[model samples]
Target: MLSVKKLEAFYGDFQALFGIDFEIGESETVSIIGSNGAGKSTFLKTVCGQLKAAPSAIIFAGEPIGGKPANEIVAKGIAMVPEGRRLFRSLTVEENLLMGGFAKRSGPWNLKRVYQLFPALEEKRNNLSTALSGGQQQMVAIGRALMANPKILICDEVSLGLAPIVVKGIYDALPKITSDGLAVIIVEQDIDTAMRVSDRVYCFMHGRVSLKGRSADLTKNQISDAYFGI
Candidate 1:
């Protein structure tokens, strides 16, 4: 459903991605794993339109969206749960979630459905966003992105500072999301989590994909090799 070909991203001349190629099929969950500075997040950022790519560089649902603006991309059925869970500090939990649907895509995502996914958010819907725990905040981020009712959900680092058990709880929810027919592209540094949750894995090295295959097909040594560019 999504494809990036020969994608090159730069921050004022310091290019972070070099001819990166990746694809995510419908209802597929793909993981991008690599060490810091490997450009995994940059890959997602480019896909989400936070960073622009040259025409023909990125395609989604068979259309060229390389240089499109972020909102335009969201409207085209792609939404991202960005890293750091960048929620509005002043907005209530529910308010943050509501903002997620501002794209107004016609589909199954709604505040009630998001609340159902994270029931805790229902009870504390009115609470301040920053008051929630890290995991809870991550849930809000996920719920907010879901509110867009996207065909492809790109999550950038869903498990950052949360506890192990909390991370597990979040991964456990992916099956439900896929069951609901959402394709997920998760950018994660956690190898164990990537191996467990991803259908396929792509390992990045120096702003390029060095290794890729089904998650079960990737061995520890192979992952290490690609991750370190060894």
Candidate 2:
């Protein structure tokens, strides 16, 4: 239930996204795959309101929210699990998760529910956030975002530094997280993970969509062509 149109993002004089057009339907999982500097993260940042854009660029649930502040966006049912698992090291795991609920939106997601989604977090609820492993930390990040009970969840580089098995564990939990008609936009460098978990895939190249289609229908050759801009 989100639409991005003619989305052009810039970093001072250097532009990153080139009129990127994308959409995320209700309860849909959309993956964005691209190499470094392809603007995949840029797109997520723009959608999450970290990178400002024109008011008409991003529409969520039919209203334009492009230039809104990040807090406002989160309040409007969009939450982001940014790259690097930027958790509050000083806070306990539970405290970090509680921060997400500051939005105070009413929904199915809550501390109890998030704990059910990642049972491991329950045991570590009182532990220092920095003490958790990378995967556990990632879980905390995801759980933190879920605490907002968002309609759309944006995950940027969720698998960046975790082990393969750990990444798989994280991806495996996505179905349950999105089961309640939540739209998800995942920015992943791992093509296989992206293709596996997403209903549709969008390959970015040089700050634009080189290919977009059903994940199951997109052959390896087509993905390679789009991925490398061949």
Candidate 3:
């Protein structure tokens, strides 16, 4: 449902992405894996409209959406759960989730659905967002994005600081999250988790795609070489 062709991005004179070509079909799960400074996050930020690109670079549902405002992109059905799970610490759990619905997009995701997806949030609906544990906070971030009823969900480092078991709990919900044919792009540091959850994987190096292939088909040797730019 989204296609990025020869996409390039820059921060002042220093370019971050180098002619990156990426695409995701309806209901597909794609993972982007790379080391630090590989431009994984930059690519995502550009897609989410935090960074600028040529209007013809990003095509979503057959329309060029590059360089549009972030809110406009969210309204057009793309929502991102950022690396830090940037939740509003001052707001109650419920109130934080409610913020995502400000766009008023119509979809199957709502407060009730989100609660069902992560039952813990329901129990602490009135608690301050920062009062929750790291895992719970990540759930809130995902739920907040879901509240926007997006067609494509972009998750950057969803498992960054959480424990293994907690990460599993969050990852286990992916099937249900994508059951409605919602496309997902995951930028994960954990290669195993990224490979397991996604149908395809792209390895980035030096601001470009070093390798990409079906997750199940890529061998350890190939991924190792590609991941480290061998």
Candidate 4:
């Protein structure tokens, strides 16, 4: 479980998030949706320790972990699949996955399990990450994060550049990924997909939480109004 209270972030005084509060429970899937510059990514960065925050701002598994180093955060059981898929061009697919395990945490995810999750990765395990198709590269990114065996997995824009079918395949795997009680936070631009995949949804606008509710309870007009400040 994780809790964020009055979270704020900045880049040299240019603030990006404003008093945002959020929480996730075990095995829960939460989605964050907003337009560009809505601070979705900024909130994630602060959570994963890429950006600094007040010590009391972020409480994970009951302890305050704000402003810790990224590596330390990963060791504390939070892993992120960044927006760009950010795979290592020089490393082979398997090697890139192995990099994620540098934290050396113990859990259900490993090479064999990841391969089972995405059969394509096993077939091209030795190929350079850059050589894979966009979808496959995204698989490698997800697989890489899973390799960390994190309690909380954060995925940013997993469907960004992929084909619809490819995106579907990835989204379809969510049930399996979270079956082990892994909490997931997804930052998505596709509102429909976000609503479909998450139990709860948070809409961000201009660095603040504009609306939040159970995904099924939110009407299209409500989401539209919150999303666009209409």
What's each prediction's clash count?
A: 0, 0, 0, 0
| Candidate 1 lDDT by residue in tens digits, 25-90 | 988999999999999888888888888789699988899999899989999999999999999999
What candidate 1 gets wrong by more than 4 Å, as runs, is: none
Model 3 weakest 10-residue run by lDDT: 221-230
Tens digit per residue, CA lDDT, model 4, 149-173 = 9999999999998999999999899
TM-score of each: 0.98, 0.98, 0.99, 0.99
For each candidate, the alpha-carbon lDDT, in order, equals 0.91, 0.94, 0.96, 0.97
Q: What lDDT tens digits, residue by residue, belong to model 3 across residues 88-174?
A: 989999999999999999999999999999999999999999999999999999999999999999999999999999999999999
Give the higher-TM-score candidate: 2 or 4: 4
- What clash count does candidate 4 reach? 0
Candidate closer to the true structure by lDDT (higher is better), 1 or 2: 2
lDDT of 4 at 197: 94
Model 3 TM-score (2 dp)? 0.99
- Candidate 4 global Cα RMSD: 0.6
Comparison by lDDT, 1 against 3, better one: 3
**Alpha-carbon shift of residue 60 in model 1 (angstroms):** 0.5
TM-score-better candidate, 1 vs 4 = 4
Q: What range of 10 consecutive residues in model 2 has the weakest lDDT sum? A: 43-52
Candidate 4: lDDT of 202? 98
